[model samples]
Target: MNPKMSSPKVGFLYPGYAAEDDYPRLGKMVNPNVDVELIITEFNEDAHTVEALSEMGSNRRIVDGTKHLVGKGVQSVLWTSTSASFVRGLEGIKEQIATLEEQLNVPASTTALAFVRAAKAIGAKRVALAATYPEDVALLFKVLLESFDIEVIQFASKGIITAAEVGTLQKDEVGNLAVENDCPDADALFIPDTALHSAEWIEDLEEAVQKPVLTANQVSFWEALRLTGQFTPQKGLGTLFKQELPKEGELDVIKS
Candidate 1:
């Protein structure tokens, strides 16, 4: 067993209308240690307008939010919003990470980047995706993932347009989407919004599809584990988290 030291503390910067239950589940999966704090932001609800999507106060607000957690001695911070991370474009996500790292002087990454990094870390050259966004938004996400050399093997969008509705979606609906859109050749599957709670359904989805089922929440959790150099096979979450920790000679993707 890994040494039972105090687990790392992480702060999650949530965009408007995000699920409140996710951070605790992440702490439970990390197990025995690691604090997870939710830092929610105030913003408009509709996801259709550029003003709402751009979220004027977002960039600085996230930095200030994370700094609050860092002051509490949190080891790392993650911005856990898909629309805000992706809608502004991939470079925008990079800029967000840059902003947080500069403020807290700690390692930081956005959920959008974490998703891409996790896919590559697992050697997922071909991947299937299930999104709750509309077709146009889903296509933008597809383009983002493709930039990382992970091919989109199959995709299906739920056509949900509002941020609030996305947060309230049922777990069974997400599980069904994972099962239906899975592709035989895909190395892994991804569900791409932190607002949508998917931590509870990943294992079942992996079993049905026979591949690593990664959700936005799952990868964000995984990235925090990497930041703290903690990797243990966690049951009840999914294949990705259930993966054994790397030994001395093994290629550690989390480190690399």
Candidate 2:
């Protein structure tokens, strides 16, 4: 086992209560010594539409969310919403990360950037995306990945309109989504949606697809750990965690 960091703490500015519990669960399962703090950001609407997501990820809302994490001594923070971040595109996401780092005075990233980093970490050239957003919204993630040279060989969108509905999904449904959308030519399956609970089902989903399953919540936490330099290969969290992070400057897609 890698030597644990002494009381390392990471904060997350999550949008709502859907799968927020995954962070604490991951802390316990991956490394109990690391503190995982979550501050729920308020949103006007929980819909998966672009307009709603744009509003949810606005700089004001993000800065407001950081109020609770200011004095927590967190090493890094992550905006744990894939659609919300990706909807802004790469430049927009960069602005978002800048806003986060400025407010918290720590290295910060978002779930959208996390997906790209995770894909490069595993050396996945071709990936299959299984998104829970509408086709238009999901296409933004494809664009974001392709910006980093990760090909989207197969894209599948569930067209779910609300985070609340996705939060209600159970393991079986989440597993089937991965298995069904997986492609033989793809190096990994990317599921983008922090509202869904996927940390506990990583092993089963990877087994079913016989490939890496990169879910939103899973990558979000992994990105937070990466920021703190506390990442170690852990069992049952799928191939992303098991692989070594890309060496500094290897994949310079996003400079968080």
Regions of candidate 1 where Cα sits further than 4 Å from its true position: 48-51, 244-256
**Ten contiguous residues with the weakest lDDT in model 2:** 1-10
lDDT (Cα, tens digit) per residue for candidate 1, span 185-253: 889988887778877777778888898988888888777766666666677877767666444533322
For each candidate in turn, the TM-score is: 0.88, 0.96
Give Cα-based local distance difference scores for all models.
Answer: 0.74, 0.89
Spell out the clash pairs found in candidate 2: none
Q: For candidate 2, write residues 9-99 as lDDT tens digits.
A: 8999999889889998888877445688899999999999989999999998999999999899999999989999999988889999999
Estimate candidate 1's RMSD in Å: 3.1
* 201: Cα error in model 2, Å: 0.6
